[model samples]
Each structure stands twice: as structure tokens, then as C-alpha cells.
Target: MHHTRLFDSYICLDPSMWWDNQALLKETKRALETRRFHGTSLYLGIANTADEGMDVTRVLTDTTTATLHMRSALQLQRYFEHNQQNGLKYRGKYYQDDSHMSVPFIAEYEALRFLFGAERK
Candidate 1:
């Protein structure tokens, strides 16, 4: 079961949901331009699903964010090697044997290691 499918029945029907992207982008640019660092840091570990609508290229452009691209998992493509080679603070890990729903088991572990500088066992 894909993660989104599990929540398919609970999607929001509110009209305000669509108003935020444009506003948010404008605010984000202003913040960035003003050098107002958000005071918190985040590491993104996207599954890099082949059909994902979010543009990986754009997301990875932000140097402050580190991403872990899952290469062999369902929904994602093989992106780890190229991204890693480019010195983008991204790591590639394989979960070739797991389904999308099962990826969290291994990915969560890898994410912790990536964020905390732990050695992989």
C-alpha cells in the first residue's frame, strides 16, 4: 500500500488549500533575500519516485538542505550515484527489495545515520 493511498479518503475539500503556494513563494523569496535564515535546519529524504510531481532538481538546488535519494525503492528512480558524485550533500541508499510502504523501515534508519553522522553498520 502506497503511503498516499492510505490517506486517499481523508483529503481536504477546503477552498483555502489552493491559495498558499503563490503567497508562500513570495514570502520565501523575501525571507531568503533578507538573509533571514529560518532558524531551523532540515534534511530531506525523498523517495525520488519516478512519478513524483515535485521537481528534484529544484529542491536539490538549496544547499542548506541535504537529501537522501532512495535508488531502488518503488516509485523512485536511481538518482543516488549522480547526486552523490556532484558533492550535493545527498546520499543514495538502496532498498531494492522493499515496496514503497516497506521502505520506511530501512530508510528511517539510514536517515538517522545521515543526520547524526553515525557509521553505517
Candidate 2:
């Protein structure tokens, strides 16, 4: 999960090998190249679990410093999001149909709060 005070938004994603896929990685690279998206600065991250292969976690921070961090996170996020898949491809994958994955938003929020801060603007 990733959090940013600039946009006041948090995002969580499954850590699957999809991140390593060449196609998705390329698309993500293209997206980042645009530099600006809908007036909000974007950041991405990837978290690895023993079960899932790799997953992309994205955080959008509009501020300059946050944006820079987001860029690095984006690189990591793309690495996993495009490469992993369930079953034969990824192995021992976890799947969630809803926006919230196996990980809860509140839990992720708390983590972000710890990582970023508790205050909300």
C-alpha cells in the first residue's frame, strides 16, 4: 500500500508476477512518461509476499518530493504488476475480486499513517 498527503488518497494492489510482464511494464513506463496525469502527481510501489509472486502498489502524491518518491515506487510497482499471474505462471497466487485485496484498506491506512503520518489535510 502507498499513501500520499498531496492527494489524500491511498492505494493497495495484489503482489503478483504480472508486474514483470513486458507488456504491462511498457504501458506503465509510457504512463509515467506523460509526467502529469489529471493534475495529480503519481507514485507507485510493489510489495512482495511469500504467497504471491509480485504485486504493484501505487501511491499518487502531488507534491514535488512525494512525486519523486512516487516515481521510484512506480518503477517497483511496474516490475511486479506486469510479471506475475496465478496458477502455472505465478504459483501459489492469491486472488481478490473487489477493490480491496486480501489486505484491508483500514490496515493499509494504518500502515500508511505510520509510514507517512496520521494527520490528514
lDDT of 1 by residue, 62-109 (tens): 332222222112112232222232222334453434434665666677
Could you say which candidate leads in lDDT? Answer: 2
Candidate 2 accuracy as TM-score: 0.32
**Residue 74 miss distance in model 1 (angstroms):** 9.2
List the candidates' TM-scores in order: 0.33, 0.32
Candidate 2 residue-pair clash tally: 22
Say what the RMSD of model 1 is. 13.5
lDDT, candidate 2, 1-121, per-residue tens: 1222256333334333233443444564554444233322222223322223223332333333423333343554544345332111111112222232444454454445544646376
In candidate 2, what residue range of length 10 has the lowest lDDT sum?
86-95
lDDT, candidate 2, at 96: 27
- CA error at residue 51 for candidate 1, angstroms: 16
